[model samples]
Target chain A: MAESKKPDSSRRSERSRRAIYEAALALVGETGYARTTIEGIAARAGVGKQTIYRWWPSKAAVLLEAFLDVAEQAAQGEPLIPDTGDLEADLKLVMRATVDELNSPPYDAPARALAAESVVDPGLAAEFVGRLLEPQLQLYVHRLRSAQDAGHVRAGVDPRIALELLVGPLAHRWLLRTLPLTHAYADEVVEYALYGLAPRP
Target chain B: MAESKKPDSSRRSERSRRAIYEAALALVGETGYARTTIEGIAARAGVGKQTIYRWWPSKAAVLLEAFLDVAEQAAQGEPLIPDTGDLEADLKLVMRATVDELNSPPYDAPARALAAESVVDPGLAAEFVGRLLEPQLQLYVHRLRSAQDAGHVRAGVDPRIALELLVGPLAHRWLLRTLPLTHAYADEVVEYALYGLAPRP
Candidate 1:
């Protein structure tokens, strides 16, 4: 409903793409990954089946692109982890933003559907992680590497694994619904992960 | 196919129940939670529909019970986390066992199905956590509390949240398939979570 008044070919194509993404996300959210189909998305988006098939090879691919589009918009095309020199505050700010995004209605349901589907489907899981999840993870890796260079993080720490120490808890809590993923919880995750759980000198 | 030679009521019931758990796990593993049905489970288990209905209210209930049975048997009824004096070694041992369970075929597929279902289904997720995940988490909580008493952990650390630093990485790696969840990765999770990512004193 929020398309531009301009009728250029580029504008029209963008509108159609956005509409298809919305339809795909809503379908997967309500009906789940198993039932969501390319035909269903095309019908809901008011586009031809050929159009969807032309743009993406399969329903999984379409959904995957849609997910990437949504996630990019969620971060507003900025790097997820900021490099503001002060690591702790930056981590808190970014993590708090993640908490908000994870809670937001537009992104929440479809992401959960995709995540749920990925669990049983190994190939899908690998593709989704490689394309979508790992890139975002690399944002943390970049930030952590910068942190280590700044001496904010230990030189001995592996940025890849170190990032998991941060992302894993939030993902676990968010995906499992075991507890509330509040800003407070996000802050605590950062604090505990950066400091020794043992008695510190 | 493994029913007993004995025709006594209790013995027959026991065999039937095992068959049902096996059937439910297989169906869910292959077909996923959305498509798995009580009728299918009944047919696969060689039991009548009324027999399934007599024992469980819904497919969710049947799957839940089946998952509990499998998880229990996976651990061989051992305590999830050992209460040995060294918290790091104990966590690594438990996490290694977890990696093995997650790799095992019978437990892997069915557990993934149940976990995936739980993500989008609130009631199922709640029951799964309350009955399965959290009870297991509380086992770590007990171990952490013991660690605190032994002066291995900071008294100020919340055992509940503290345990997440250990389990969350493993769960995230397992559920998402972002990385190979090996014993080495498990050991790294234990090390990073315990001593943390910052340069130590």
Candidate 2:
């Protein structure tokens, strides 16, 4: 009977965790980050405030975890960019997927809310970079290293920096809303990063 | 006597405007955008709230114009990227200057505040891109066009899109705080954008 109770409690904990994540994302999306509160999240999730405080210390932590969960779900448990032996094709596929995600409503609002707050909050910015952005970027780093091994990428190129050439332009266009972020734009970014802008010598 | 009085009033108005710009910048820098208000700006500037409202519609407007004033001052009235006939050298110089400006305290704080707010605020983002970012980007467009004319850049490259390759990475680093933004980083971005990351065929 004690063993059965343990399993039931663990199952309930998992359900509560999922509910909290959903509530945090929806609340941040609807109200900006500055306005989102632990109370609001707890209420929306139909869990007690103590439930959130027991699990997370702050709103930023909750939002960061929520974003990470959403990103993981989007990647279907595989967060790495695919390597089809064609570096250019693989990058385009990943970039196009990024464009779609950025354009989607579910991801856009909450991500923007967190990103906005991070700009002014150095502590949150560091955590965001350390936990969310860096891990994803490392995936690109591994992909580029493989390309270098296969002679697809230049041997001297730093995969860390080279990946920026692909992702940076997309982030800029999306964040600034300077232009329409299209699949075509993503393809062009991949091509430009892979080929010389100067005429081939 | 009437003409002399007219000049005095105009001088007084100009002085008041400069004071307001300074106050707005300082306040926004000290407090995040959400906390900055017209009353705070007016008190700091030693003017009535009506003075600020008479010239600007809202706090966003006041902050935007203040940023523009600071940018113009930084450019010293010459806002165009220098055209030295060496495309790589010219780009590197401009990029390095940008890195310096982004690192400076006076520009960094308020700019971050505005950038943060713009991320969640679509209306302000549009105004920001339209009024500030696009005009500056056009300078890069003109320079890239000249490079194409001189056979320095491939004619097939679109100056507008190509310019993103230069500025985007720098901005990504600056906004995300993912890495140290240095002149060396700026030079490398120019090199990668001009030469490409893939090996020469």
Per-residue lDDT tens digits for candidate 2, residues A100-189, read: 999999999999988888888889999999999999999999999999999988888899999899889998998888999999999999
| Candidate 1 Cα outliers beyond 4 Å, as residue runs | A1-7, B1-7
Q: How many steric clashes between backbone atoms does each model show?
A: 0, 0
The digit string of per-residue lDDT tens for model 2 on B82-128 reads 99899999999999999999999999999999998888888999999
Per-model TM-score on C-alpha atoms? 0.95, 0.96
Q: Please give the C-alpha DockQ score of model 2.
A: 0.80
What does DockQ give for each predicted structure? 0.78, 0.80
Query: In model 2, how many backbone clashes occur?
Result: 0
TM-score chain B for all models: 0.95, 0.95
